[model samples]
Target chain A: MVTESDTGSIQVEIIPSRFLLPATAQKLLNEIYGNGGIIRIMIHGPNLPRSVPYGPGRGSPIDENRDLLIEVGGQAFELSVKVGRIRLELESEKYYEGLKAACERALPISFQIRRGKFFHTRQTITDYAKYGKVEDTRILGLIDPKAKQDRLAILSEENVAVHDEER
Target chain B: MAYTPQYYPGSTSVGINRRKHMSGNLEKLRDIPEADVVAVMGHRAPGADYSSTHPPLKEMGEPDCPIRQIVAPTAGAAAGDRVRYSQWTDSMYFAPSIPYWRSYWGAINCKGCDPGTLSGRQIIEARERDIEAYTKAQYDSEMTDVALCSMRGCTVHGHSLRLEENGMQFDMLARTEMGSDGNVYAVKDQVGIPLDRKINLGKPMSEAEAKKRTTIFRVDGIPMCGKVGARKYDEAVDALHHMWELRSKWGFRPE
Candidate 1:
């Protein structure tokens, strides 16, 4: 269960002008993760299906841009979507500057940083129906509730230590 | 008194480009070989004879009618060619041509053709040979920016999506890919069937060139409702508004 103090975390969304390649996304993630002020991060984009979903090419293999692996903070995971927008939950308002700097260092194209409520603060009815009594509120909207496998990739110990120290 | 047809109304570059497309006065940008175009189309093998639906008009005597006599049969129609279709998905991010404009181009320029315009993609159906000629014309002209437009026969889902970092439009089937040599290539047919060899589609236009050539009125480039800083409807909008007003009035009372 998340305490009342955790509800005050600042949320920021980074929307790039173009969908980033897996390597570019990894670079961006590494840069941002290195900054140490982020509590949680979620990458969002259009899904790259494993097979041709419909039409005459249905069931055909689509290898390009699908099943890509990206490492962030020493943890690697398969990227299902082409990275377009990245939403972050920061410990405080002070971390916004660091986040902006990280984006600048990694991105070659223009991007927009918007500060607002982008994630669910608490579990909803749908979350209850899908997840069945979620314990960690931070993981509330990180992934699709009906996803077969957990998409969350926990970073290394040092990164978790930094998050723990901030708390 | 004589009146010239004003294809589209606006002082902006977008309007001018639209007019050029509708008038079939597009500048030839590349010379993709007919065989390569045919391969990308995936209808038949290169150098193969066109399959026909019916006997040639010369052999199958037509009814002696004034309409039939006045309209001379096109090459494909005279040869009794099969009706075939070609579809294109143009990126919304400053693609040279949009679905509506493509339909307009087909309607105004092509003979014995049917053009369909959807939200994301546009398609033209004509006799097999005629469609091939039309497809080649579009591929060779400024109407198609290879990176921003693609030949998608089915599962057309990339028009409104953000482009890849390399600037190529998002294609779910991976029909086309940008080669390391800086030119785009079609590795697969329009329907996602792998081609025997990659066909070079020439270099993509620069961002500035695409913006200048694009018929879409975008907020970042040229806004349909207003300029960059100013707030005034473009001449195209005004013309459309006038037409709508007259249409509504006529609809109420057909005099």
Candidate 2:
């Protein structure tokens, strides 16, 4: 039951895969859940690969200096970012060459993973036959660090890939 | 016994005698009673001797100030349909001498010689001074006062219509009673001017009678009252004439 004291208990689902920029995703997050609280969950898109850095790479070193964990409303939450390159690395890349190739070809998409259960849910992008148009409300929430490659894959699959190569 | 006939020279029964035989005329005038004169003139005539020979009406019909015609019924008509003749004229005067006399004698004459001792220039100056004083006094007296027409100057037999200067504008004061038709008609003046003309009492007198009186009141191609700028003096006089003609249809004759 939601009460006046449950003000801080409110959670926001950020669909990072939907928004174009990180700032746009953050703005939508601020609008829905306000600015002061912790963003509890992120539902990463299925097409996005999951990968992390294993060995020391040739390129610039990752700055893991910043605290990845943020405290909100007395609750400790883990911050996870979805990168398309990380997703590609999870599926195929085993060495520095694969990582570099993934970095070049793959788009970065991230989502916050916390407590095993999915708080953010995905809405289906149906064919134009069942629904004439898609409404913004159908997009339940945006995932942080939107998945660009996943969107490309979805557009190509729908056969509505009009401005692909240049865009 | 035979009675002797007494005869006064240059005497006639009509009572008009030469001015020279004044004493004889006086005695004869005394013998005739005041009532006899009234009886001869007629019982309806005004008690005053306001005959055509009177100074005011004497020159009335002359070219100088042409006589005004009567457009209403004469005084001899029925009770509800009679017209009476009444008129008054204003005479203005100028008295220039009073101020000049006072100033000249008070200032200059007191310091100087008598009449015989004065020089030619002094005489001319004195005469000029007197003339100036007289002319100014006359002008002042002329402009100072005006004779107003009022109910006091009116007669019971006829309604009185007065035209007086109201500030800078001229207006008419009409005093009258209701007619047989229950509509009040202004008493037409001796000069045929109606009191207030807005009522359309002169032409096409009423809605029903309009067709009959239209020809009489229409002048210069317009009905007198409806004419443009009818409030102007000449237009007003024309309108008054129109009203007079309407009243005359009822047969009121001016004396």
Candidate 3:
């Protein structure tokens, strides 16, 4: 288990003026991942439900802006929410300027980068109840514990090298 | 003395816009075809006959009463048309009209109608023909911007959410899409039913235009309590405060 003092990572949140499309999100993610100082990143937005959740059109298929596929750092994942805010844990405060520069290059609209403790440093009772005996502390509060599928997409040099060799 | 109605009180643009809406004196922004409006409403097919609920008022023959003799029936009521409804969801981002203002407009202008206002949506129910007329007027007037305000019967979400990258409101069903031709089009009806053909809603107004025309008060545009440099309550707020004070005082002791 990695303690908070051991890592000494800093958290920052990137908030855009508007929600991003899948293509735009992919571009932003690639830019941030390429910069190579991010320890972990969490995307936040409103859920794009697969079917109509309520009202007269209940259970109807909603094809638009749902189940979008985005590739970042050669890892493709299905995005279920509209990209609104991106919270990143950096190795140190030195990478904050680089992160802002990355956002500037990827986003056409105005954005704000706020420095704060955005992520939960330690697991709570709910996390323990949902995910019994967590082994990886880095992913403590990265995702919704109740979600059936794991939303994490690990991007490492070794994994990329293996993917490139296979290709 | 002839009594003149003052719709609202304020010197800000929002107050002016509210007065314009309440007085039914909005500028016509677009001319969406009658058939297209009908298609988006999804209540009945375009050019189809309006179904009736009862016999014509003249034929039905009301009882001999003073109120009945004085009040004339509306066109739809006279024709014995069934009651129908239209609903709208307006974005929080400087939408031309909000739910409360829309309800106010309906109460002031329309006859024999029920206007319901919710946090994110507003609905009006009236006789079939009258509702169609009201819907068409709202679509064509400056009260609605196609990108920021949309007709939504069910699953009415996205009013308080952030807008899409293209400046359009975030609709989960995506009933409307911005076409490559720089015009908005309705591919699906208000209830998420796919339309037989796309209905072209005119181009959306620019950000500056929407801000100028909107009734909502925002810190970025114009705050309800004046701007940062000059912090003061608007005239409308003062009026409301006066009314509230009188109401509370009267309720506590009626003399």
Per-model tally of clashing residue pairs:
0, 38, 0
Residue pairs in candidate 3 whose N, alpha carbon or C atoms collide under 3 angstroms: none
lDDT for each residue of candidate 1 in B1-255, tens digit (9 for 90 to 100): 899688999888998899999999999999999999999999999999999999999999898999999998888999999998999999999999999999999999999999999999999999999999999999999999999999999879899999999999998788999999999999888888778899999999999999999999987898876566557767888998999999888858655
Residue B144 in model 2: shift from native, Å? 99
Ranking by TM-score: 3, 1, 2
Q: How does model 3 fare in lDDT?
A: 0.87
Q: Model 3 chain A: which ten-residue window has the lowest total lDDT?
A: A158-167
Docking class of 2: incorrect
Candidate 3 per-residue lDDT, tens place, B179-236, comes to 9988999988888877889899989999999999999988888887654566687787
lDDT of 2 by residue, A1-167 (tens): 74443222333222222222223333333332222223222333222112212211112222331233433333333334321111111111123233233222322443321122232344445322222343432223333234433332121113342232332
- Candidates 2 and 3 compared: the better one by DockQ is 3
Worst 10 residues of 1 chain A by lDDT: A158-167
Q: Write the per-residue lDDT of candidate 2 for residues B1-255, one digit (tens) a residue.
A: 897323212122111111111222121111213332222212123244322212333333434332223333222221121122112221111111112222332233222112211110111112222322322221122111112111112221111111111200011222222345543333432222222231212111222222221112234333334445645433335545777889878766677
Residue pairs that clash (backbone atoms under 3 angstroms), model 1: none
lDDT of 3 by residue, A4-116 (tens): 56346888999999999888999999999888788889898887877777766677777785669898888778998889999989998777888899999999899999988
True contacts kept of each: 0.66, 0.00, 0.63
Off by over 4 Å in 3: A1-7, A124-126, A150-167, B1-3, B226-234
| DockQ rank order | 3, 1, 2
> What DockQ number belongs to candidate 3?
0.54
